[model samples]
Target: MTDTLTTLRAQLLASVAVIDEALKAVPPEAVQLDLPKPAAFFDRLRGRLWPRMSVSQVQGCERILAACGHAGFGLAWTAYVLATAYHESGYRMQPIKELGGDAYLSKYDTGRLAERLGNTPEADGDGVLYAGRGDVMITGLDNYVRATVELRRLGIIGEDVDLAKTPERVLEPAISAAILIYGMRDGWFTGRGLDDLLPRTGSATVGQFTKARPIVNSMDKAAPIAGYAIDFQAALFAGGWA
Candidate 1:
């Protein structure tokens, strides 16, 4: 890692550890209720949480912060995105064809025809179908199709590449992370800065994301590129960028 990245990583890790400690003190239910609405309260939480995200999460935060030009806004953005992921994929794995296996893609789709049915789900195999994709949490093939085209257009991913055949592209943390960033950039669904607000909003602030439409739009335009770069760097660190 570059000196700047290393320094930033240490700082971020330090902050996240502190935040984790603080969060541990507060029950998940309490954390959920401490939503920041007022500027004063939001600022207080922001100041405390800004330095508390994990290094990786902070790296993601830095990318958003630079894109939005507001440190406070970035935390909100992160929370929104991660919360969506929690809602969509739980930061855990989903059992869809894209992330689960080739057999998860249903046989009755254009994607299967496009892939020449290279892979199909069998009744005896991975039975789950219609997995989610990208950040802001896109679900089903319809959404993935839209995002694949968008990623191709943005040069973040390749066009004509079969999303079904490459499940790793959907599940790889780096790829998944980048796509979340990219989807936000592409105005996926709301195109809101959910990832940025994740920290300040906490669990209780789920309703706030619905209110911040413009910030979401801005994040939608910028997150893909920034996330792609950061995720790629992270992939390199994990020896998976190639």
Candidate 2:
């Protein structure tokens, strides 16, 4: 038993050393996004999709790229994520609260949807309070609870954080990028994940991109998002995608 313990200790030390080497091999700049053709790529979307592009949009894209960090999501999945963010936030590319303010957001406070969302109808104003927030627009008490768990499970947030109570924390660019990245990757929004629609081995075709709408929403504006994904894929390749 003493010999076994000594062997186990040596194995763990070796494993940790290998992990340290692997981490060192991937420098910080390895994750930083340097768009090779920002003018030729995103500029195409400038007047056509977004009225005007800003530094915040570029920062948001970089945040997502950093959060992704060699996840083997491939160019297709990466582009799809960018497309989802584009459509979901109306091309703002930043975390945004759902429009319509309190009155419109109150819709989540009533009916069966409210029950599923863990909303207390006509009490506490949880619908408006925890209303859709983030690049992925994580909405409702139920989603907040789930996002909090996912964020914490991935070590992106502290155990002291409770998203349902402080939903606005999702607005932070890093937090928002994490939510969008893992939310779609893990299927937090719907039962369908990125791998579900676009398998790891298979390439994402135009039709597949349209079908991938379920990864976030249920076929809402599928066509336009697909178009965006195709365009975004070009940008990813320009950035030296593997």
Candidate 3:
């Protein structure tokens, strides 16, 4: 493996170890009530989709999970998302589920859709159209428009990008993880951070622990078998498991 890939793999392995250790100290019964059976959810989705969906659909999501390091809650998150993706629109092969395919999907009026939404900058040659497409769950024109500008500022994307054109950017796991982590740190998440997210009624009703339980349980199940599981949980504790 390349040095960069090796380094990232090591980091991912370390993170998984942290999560594994933290879970061991906490009793499964204590967290059992919060856990959901993602497998059951998966089965229901498969039945509904019927002949249209296939195992390949599930495999596609697992590929993403593996790319991002299948550790702790991340693995469970992958299952949840994969199930959703299969049930939602069948892996985005359909135009309706595609963020940029449907003309109506641009209600947010940012990035690429701004011009169509009657924004004056439609005539501006220096607009970058943003389509929050693909696995990172990018959404709305505004996000892409802003991200394009940000990328330009960082010298990663050019300033004169066409807003009318679909935005293109890398989506590898490490890049995606970097974007997600740095984005959260930059106050990009819906709720500030874990601390801010935890106290809100929306969050409390759902419960942070509740959302995390399935993955935690899955991680616990996988810990003994996963070579790096022990160290992953330890890192999380060090990082405060937030």
lDDT of each model, Cα atoms only?
A: 0.42, 0.80, 0.37
RMSD of 3: 15.3
Q: Could you estimate the TM-score for every candidate?
A: 0.38, 0.80, 0.36
Candidate 2 TM-score, C-alpha based:
0.80
Q: How many Å off is the CA of 176 in candidate 2?
A: 0.8
Q: If both were scored by lDDT, which would come out higher, candidate 1 or candidate 3?
A: 1
lDDT string, candidate 3, 70-98, tens digits: 22234223233333232223343121224
* Highest TM-score model number: 2
**After superposition, which runs of candidate 1 have C-alpha atoms over 4 Å from their true positions?**
1-75, 91-129, 133-136, 164-168, 190-207, 210-242
Name the better of 1 and 2 by TM-score: 2
Model 2 residue 120 CA deviation in Å: 1.9
Candidate 1 residues 1-242, lDDT tens each?
59999999999999999998987874233223222332332233233334333445433433332222222223344444443443344333221223555554333233444243222333422223334444334444455556667667766566656455454366544445556655654455454444443344223232445444443333333433233333322322232111
lDDT of 1: 0.42
lDDT string for model 2 (90-119, tens) is 877889999887888778878787888878
